[model samples]
Target chain A: MPSDVSAPVSNGKPGRLRRLIAARAEGEALRKGNLLVLAVLLLVAVVALLPFYWMLSSSLRMPDQMFANPVQWIPNPINWASYPEAWGAQNFGRYFFNSSVVAVLITLGNLLFCSLAAYSLTKFRFRGRHLSFMLILSTMMLPLEITMVPLFLIVNSFGWTNSYQGLVVPFLVEGFGVFLMRQYMLSIPTDVIEAARIDGASELRIFWMIVMPLCKPALVALAIFTFREAWDLYIWPLVIITDDALRTLPLGISLFMSGYGTAWDQVMAIAVLGTLPMALLFFFLQRAFIQGIAGTGLK
Target chain B: MSPVSSSRSARPGPASSGPKTPGRRPWLTPGSKQTAFAWAILLPALLILAIFRFLPMLEAFYLSFTDYDLISPPRWVGLQNFIDLTQDPLFLKSVQVSLIYVSCSVIPVIPLSLGLAILFNRALLARNFLRSAIFMPVVMPAVVMAVVWTFMYQQDGVMNTILGWVGIDPVPWLRSSSTALWSVIMIGIWRAVPYYMVIFLAGLQAIPRDYYDAAKIDGAGSWATFRYITLPLLKPTMLLVVVMNVIVAMKVFAVPMIMTGGGPGDATRVLPLFIYQTAFEFFDMGKASAMSVVMFAILMAFAFIQVRLFTRKEEQ
Candidate 1:
């Protein structure tokens, strides 16, 4: 018989049989425990996704059946009219265009400007380098909520109110993006940069050709982060945009809800449409998204 | 420039690229060129921030001390807006409501998110699928969440129907002053818990696996392993989550703005919402700036601690 360190050994057939049974029981218990954990986690995940399911299902339900008694978990004869009606009711096309422009510009601007600044902060030794980095870091404390008033006055002074620049310029470069990029850049080997310098590569050429490509993971993460934040911009647009034509998707959806409050089906439809772009973005870049969020906390 | 040249000279290599020009100033070395290049690249970001963030921040402080409405020029009224805010009932109510929101939403999130993180950290069937499922809420935009939750919170709506399954009465969620803040609080927790859970999972994964294995060899139970091996190492992440979550909760604007509009007698009137109304709706820019300064101070207090913790970790 094979010797077991933890289990008592006895020189007999009965002892070997008993050991086999005990090991089998332990294995059975472990499998059952795993099943229990899986079951519990599945339940939590269901609850987490329940709202999304409700949003989609409610969007497909007929107007009258939305508040049906006992709650129809699934819509019967799924109504597709809400989408078209909702889209027709508002200038949703304009709103989607506005959101896309603002978010894309903001994302691209962050990727470019933040990477340039991060490269400077990480790769170069200069006077006030630390001070400049700290200055940028301190801005994280001054979110749009606190600075929006003066920011509004400043935008108004520039004659930017009711303009796209009003929405996009203030948020073109974020403190968090710089900080995220800086943290990621710190991990890069200075030896490689030094070697590039020895090869007589210009500073800008090194940043553009060598450094930027190596930082793809962080850049991808920052891109998605900035895009989502820009797309989700509500308060800034609400404050600056008085022109209905320039309103973003969130602003448009809010107006739609208040103006047509009782049209729950249509409201859900707008909600779904508004959420779809972000959901798709997240789905495609799930790994980068998770890594980006995890990076912030870990760092 | 002298400091830049000296710092560069302190380094052993990379000073060999450019020729040493005769009779040149000490500061006009290769290092100076590098410094100039760095500043050139950094100029755009610094300029943008100067215009948008730093300038406005300074302006907010200045405007808080003046009486400014959009039409007339800002009239210097030292301490008037601050004094008025101290005695304003609605402002006080907003402060109270915001405190309630921040505290209620932040406190429970720590454990709930940490617990969820621990669960998701375990090896299980389709674990990635489950984590992704739970993470779906974070993808939903805040505006959509507010609108959908408003639909679900109606008296005869899905929330009430779910409560019925548990033998509870249909509660008026957003209509009543008493329950309105709590309703907002529920949504805050729902959205936050998943986001922070991901953070906590990251923290969990960071802990060296050898510690847990050592604990198991010592016959330690799961609870003991978690208490000793998990919690201590996760201190930094816990601090990060707390500070981030509190800042986020304090800035809870879109959800309440869209759902209740700080309604049912200012029950859900968070600070940002009140600041918005005070500035734009009432055109009381000075008073709103004062409120914003107060909010900034509160957020800075939390941020100060975070900076301290992170800097200390870096030093170690």
Candidate 2:
């Protein structure tokens, strides 16, 4: 009777019969609650994944079978022709290559430059260091949408429009990247850095040898975040890159949609193609991905 | 964040670290030398941000006053653009539409995401797999998301097909003026909810399990526990999610642009989209910059208030 506090098991407690019934009912109710929670989560997961499933299934379907009634959830024969056809239908190969180079370079640049800056800011007590960090923090508040036209003009003035400079340089060292790195670096004990210094290691050597190695998890998270943002460069590329040669994947996909409005099979193929790099990155780096997000939330 | 504490812990025993040289390099490194080194290391990134981000942000302010369209030299119009916007119906409509869109996307997104995060925070079956499944939407490319949603929202599309099975008539999601803004908001929620859920899940995990154990000993109901314990403790994360969602919703461009093209007569023509058309498509940089100024002011006010509120909470 004293064991279960939830339903108040009744040895001599008032309403003994009712108490026993209530405990049994509470057990049943608990089971039902678990089932209900699972059901709700299942529904949400389905909704989240349905689009990916639909896009992949459509990418494998023939053109005629795409718009068929009853909504083809799975392609019957799983036609693989759309992959090549969509690749060749437009300059998707070029687009893929361009996006890859831009994304990777920007990611590498952020890793090297942001980590250097963050490490220095967190480790050193210097003049205007606080001011410098504050200046960087302030930029995060200004939406790229508000600054888009002016940023475009700035790039245009430098003769960077329609070039890699336009696509990559404007985003190379992000405020958010700097912030993330600095937050992560704050956890690193200064004792280690001091020991390195006493051992006559140069500052650069200390950073490269000691600090960078210890910061691998944070670096992986930053690399993935930076890569995803660079890969998703849509509005800026759309504004600046009017040339077919420099079109990134998102721009390329939009152009594909506009140019081939009726080609759902090909459109879905390109959509799936555009999503896989990011999706695969998420798959391999799921831990860092979640950690990156959680880090931003927590600190 | 104060200099004293950071310097105390971070500064090497400069006297020992400088043992390599005689009088030329003293036994203790000077503070100015460290400042110089910090500036040198930080210079490249600072230079990039100064030229790209900070400069452009200022340019948005200065350019708002001038009538320049990349062709002719600047002509100062000095508040005329702002004055004209007061009478411009389309600009006015965009402000309304943007507010509605932002509000709609954020209000429902907060509760839904937090609730989902709470559900998954427990020790449950298939936890990681279900999390990855739910989080799949946030990782999908925005362009890809908009395109696929366009597919599902077609009049006879999957949305209606599913609705039909529920004994409901097909609803034209993207085609009608009344539903276009809401449809865009729905997709915004679809993508945003899971992302914020992860943030809330992190917040929930951070709460010590001992608090919940204490509540159990006190015989508190689940609702009482959550209301008093979980909700208050999640305040910081909640504030972040709310502010971020608001800002993101204000800048909703590619989705409505691709989904509806602000179609059915400006139903989804949000402020950012309007600014785009004014600056690029129509080549009216003055008016566009003015619109951006208005948008910036509103965002700044929201951000300023939230930050102040957060700092006040910390002080208490």
Candidate 3:
């Protein structure tokens, strides 16, 4: 087929004319295919974003006019009061504070500790090295349901229930973070570490100075992922946090829905606020966010 | 709960070339110093994992067999909790419900996502814009998704209104037990498709373009190219998507918990929700642990298959 097309049908003018027409037809088909792909993707994107768009639009939907019959696609008279009303309706301010503090602390802990552990694993050779690596790897697959009981008991033993320690400590350094940092750290050459060591830099110093900086991209990815995971904490917090004041954003939103009963506008407003931090993180670290999943070759 | 980070199996590598100066620093570090260094750096992570992670993971197995109610010392009752679960209709029903939910949501996702990926793989106009728009839900916390969907699925809400446009009746999305599980499952698919699409898109992008060029020159149609070149190459990625999605789907708790609280009846009460209620609401820790162990066994079987698949591929 290729020979026939490229040989230019060297015999005649009719053949050359046919080839030009065929090429033009192919271009038209290519254009047609492009349009089809574009149309399908666009349609799917609209459907995918519809709920988010609804959350935003409905949040802005006028509180009194929220019940208008035909489904207000756009809030005809835009309302910003729901944002303030929703914020005041519950302990959302407190929820926001708790979520931020916990997410930040967890992210910082993961960035520091996971890197240390990964660096140790990648740069050093020791007895039972493979065992420890596999052990950490195994924990990554253990769902919270499997371990929640004993973990709850352990947290309760320390009198940490309803406290920040219970929410913050168990998730401080996750297995995903450890594995991510380790994979990236493996590509960091050992020569840099050896030189730093020969110069009498402490192991901690080398990790802090040489290893940490080299692992910057991975650290950013880990930080974004850790913060996202921490922000998404619901079941664990719901189980442990009995006090309403200690509720995170997820709990607060659920509580607000139940407490306010039918305040649809306010409920949507809180949903928007609940999702804001993650949206902001996506805006800034979209590359790291996508790369963390794609580069790691898992979803 | 499935770890998606760098799920590639750890494999041995070729020996590294020796240092240019062989006498310099003993090629990385000496043996004894390396062990001390490893211990020093590894202690904090190891200690934390040992206390909170490893212990709890192992204890999950033991806790399943004992009768504990959070009030007193757990008494040994080997296989009693598991046996009771077999007798409990709700637990048995939940297992059935979960299997149906996983199959319904996960099976449809592969083709839907792969289709999306194939479209986005082309250099169509506004490709990134379209890709990001679809992917936005994956970033939204599951809590927000549940709430938003709960609102949308109201009797007189946007969903029903849309259905009315097409002359369809307002189905009780969350009000009826029959549609309640499917309502949550729809949301599950909504959130899941984009995530798996991203995975599939990455897989598509990694394939060499030369394969397509060769197929095109051979007069192979688009479907033939996809069937031969794309599908075969996407096997590993497809396995990851299927296994991870199954594991994640089996653990679907937040959506069902928030949306229906297990249902108008026992319709949406999945395994995790059942476990939560048994442990916390009913204060039957032993029963909940037993259920989790059962869920764990199911997930482990999927995981084992994944390992076998990958190892087989590597051998090939």
Candidate 4:
């Protein structure tokens, strides 16, 4: 026993028996912990997707089967016709086009204006730069509620009501966009700008050629954000756009509810359809979305 | 910012004084012309924000003083809107509803988010997928959430279906005046938690692992380690999260707007929705604007205190 104890002591380590058990226990615990997290994540994923899943599943179920005594997770005979029915019933095609136009235009405008402004604020030395930046930042803290009255009056005064210009022009630019761009631009090295200038590149050329290409990550992230925001927009669009033809997706959903009544099957159909563009966008550009969010946490 | 002020006022023509060195010349670029160009790029954004965001804010202040109808010219009625708002019963109810909504929704989101962040941080596998799934709702449009949730809360919906498995009878969700606020509160939490969770996750990632190792050597259990290590380190992140959450919660419009539309006997009706209704539905811009001013003051006060508290925490 003395010889064995001395043998293990020479290694400056735990006994083989003790080491083995500790290693086994740690492995077991790690496995268990990972399994538990995965399970919880699976549950969360299910919950996150459930509404969308149910919306699709319900949309496909025969109207009679929807209210069946036992809740139906799977519709045995999927009603493919419901899609067309919903489309026709709500004039979804027109609404989809309207939403597409508005969302796309907003995205384009934001990308161009926001990037340019961000470039200037970040790259160039200007007068009242701090004050200007602060003024822009301060605008973000002011509640949109306070601005509603004057915005309405302004839009009304401009006869923008019920028109595309009314829906589009007021939101063509954003303070948040400027603020975000500025932060991102500040991170780019001053050497790059100087290098471009040394090569006889104009400011516009430098921005378009060097800076814009390098800032792809931020721009892509901002684009995804802008697209999502524009797609889901409701309140302002509802306030300004009164024409049924001009109504965006969210507005269309509300109109469907109030005008035709809360037919769950139909509403879910519209709801599911409305979520598709954003859901698809999310799936495609999820990487950029996460990066954008994580970056936001820093500020 | 410092460079901008000094550079602009001191210059008459920037071409000659544009710095002898080629490196500095590009920066000076004729009459702070580069700055002018920068401002030019920023023009559309400024113009829009000025007219829509800032101008309206000023107009809101102005409207608070008048009895302006949507159709007719305004008649000045100083303090009347504020005075009437004080006595108004619906406005009072709206205020109560808003306070309850903010308190219930904003309070749980912070710790719950932190708890979730820790959970995600400790979990080894499927971290990315889990994080993404949880945050999916945050990016989803609020109106769609309202529509989907409206379905879930229906008598025969999935929520009821799940509840029935435990033998609970169907509960009135958005329909019940008594339960409507709570129902909206739940929706608010569901829609919002992911945002805070993402923020907290970032915060959690920033905390170095060595501290945990040191605590473990001291024979601290998991909870003890968390208490001694994680919570204190998380204070800065927590303060920022809470301040942001409170400010955003105070101005919440979309959730309540689409979910309850401030309905079921005005139970879920909050200040923003009240102002919206007064302006759009009732065509009383004056009253709407007045309500907006009152809400802004309340929000500003809350924000001021939140900032002071955060700075105080930092100093300590």
Better of 2 and 4 by lDDT: 2
Task: Pick the winner on TM-score between candidates 1 and 4.
Answer: 1
lDDT tens digits by residue: candidate 2, B239-313: 888888888889988888887778879999999999998998998888888899999988888778878987787
Better of 1 and 4 by lDDT: 1
Q: Which candidate is the best by DockQ?
A: 1
Model 4 lDDT, residue A248, Cα: 83
Native-referenced TM-scores of chain A, all candidate models: 0.89, 0.87, 0.87, 0.86
Residue B122 lDDT in model 4? 55
- Candidate 1 colliding pairs, count: 0
Q: State the C-alpha lDDT per candidate.
A: 0.84, 0.81, 0.79, 0.74
Candidate achieving the largest lDDT: 1
RMSD after CA superposition, every candidate:
8.9, 8.6, 8.4, 9.1
| Candidate 2 residue spans exceeding 4 A from truth | A1-31, B1-30, B308-316
- Write model 3 residue lDDT over A46-165, tens digit each, in one string: 889899999999999987767578778989889998899989878888999999999999999999889988877766666666677778877767877667878888899999999999
TM-score of 3: 0.89
Candidate 4 chain A has its poorest 10 consecutive residues by lDDT at A1-10
Worst 10 residues of 3 chain A by lDDT: A1-10
Residue by residue across B1-316, what tens digits does model 1's lDDT show? 2565555555654332222333221222247789899899998999999999999999999999999888999999999999998999999999999989998999999999898888776545676778888888889999999999999999889999999999999999999999999999998898888889887887776665678768978999988987778987888788879888988898889999999999988999999999999999999999999999999988887678677976786576
C-alpha displacement of A159 in model 2, angstroms?
0.9
Q: Which regions of candidate 1 are displaced past 4 Å?
A: A1-26, B1-30, B304-316
DockQ winner, 1 or 4: 1
- Among residues 3 or more apart in sequence or in different chains, the pairs in candidate 4 whose N, CA or C atoms overlap within 3 Å are A126-B4, A127-B4
